[model samples]
Target: MKITPELVEHVALLSRLELTEEQKAQFSRELSKIFEYVEQLGEVDVSGVEPTAHPLPQKNKFRPDEVVPGLANETALANAPETEDVYFKVPQVL
Candidate 1:
């Protein structure tokens, strides 16, 4: 598609941008080049290529879950500066 001054002005209005005449012209040229390159890319053949999320092989690197003994509540509460019943107490936050 051809990039025109009208298209640039429309885009500027949509994007809430206030481009000068020079800026509009510069952006029009740059955007036209980008669109041309994308159009060229669309002409390439890739019928046999497989679509992939990553270039390299990827696998979930999760560790195995195992049941383990946990610290007793009394032992955990022993080091606390403040405690209310079996739980630690802290200053109230707004």
Candidate 2:
């Protein structure tokens, strides 16, 4: 299908684009060519093709989950510039 100047104007309005007359003409030609290509694709017949999620098959590789002791509070808090009793302290924000 051919894209008319009116259609280009509408598209420009929808996209909030400020197109010069030259740009509008250029876009109209490009959009028409794209529409023609799509029209050609519409003529292809693919009746029973199965929809695929991915072109290539893949398997998830994961490590086994295990409970382990983490760093103690003293070690974890060693890098903090400020800490209260057992927790890091930060300036109060309102």
Candidate 3:
């Protein structure tokens, strides 16, 4: 598609951008080139190729989930500068 000044202005407004005349001209030129490249790509043949999510094969490598013992409340609060009955005392946020 041709990248016209009107199109550029619409895009800028949608993106919440304020572009100068020079910047709009520059962006229009750059965007035109990108669209031309995409148009050129449309001419390439890929009849036999299968669409893929990734270019290379990938698999999740995860370790087995294991149960572990957790620290007791007293042990966890041992190093706190301020503590309540069994919990750390922190300032109210709101």
* Number of the predicted model whose TM-score against the real structure is largest: 3
lDDT tens readout by residue for model 3, 20-86: 9999999999999888878987888999989898989999999979988899899999999999999
Model 2 poorest ten-residue lDDT run: 37-46
Model 1 Cα lDDT, one tens digit per residue, 1-94: 6788789999999999999999999989999988887898688898998888898998889887987889899999999999999999999967
- Tens-place lDDT digits, model 2, residues 1-94: 9998889999999999999999989999999999988898677787998878999888998987988899999999999999998899999957
Question: Would you estimate the TM-scores of all the predictions?
Answer: 0.44, 0.45, 0.46
Question: How accurate locally, in lDDT, is each candidate?
Answer: 0.90, 0.91, 0.92
Better of 1 and 2 by lDDT: 2
Residue 71 lDDT in candidate 3 = 97
* TM-score (C-alpha) between model 2 and the true structure: 0.45
TM value for model 3? 0.46
Q: How does model 1 fare in lDDT? A: 0.90
Deviation of model 3 at 91, angstroms: 26
Q: RMSDs, each prediction?
A: 12.5, 11.4, 10.2
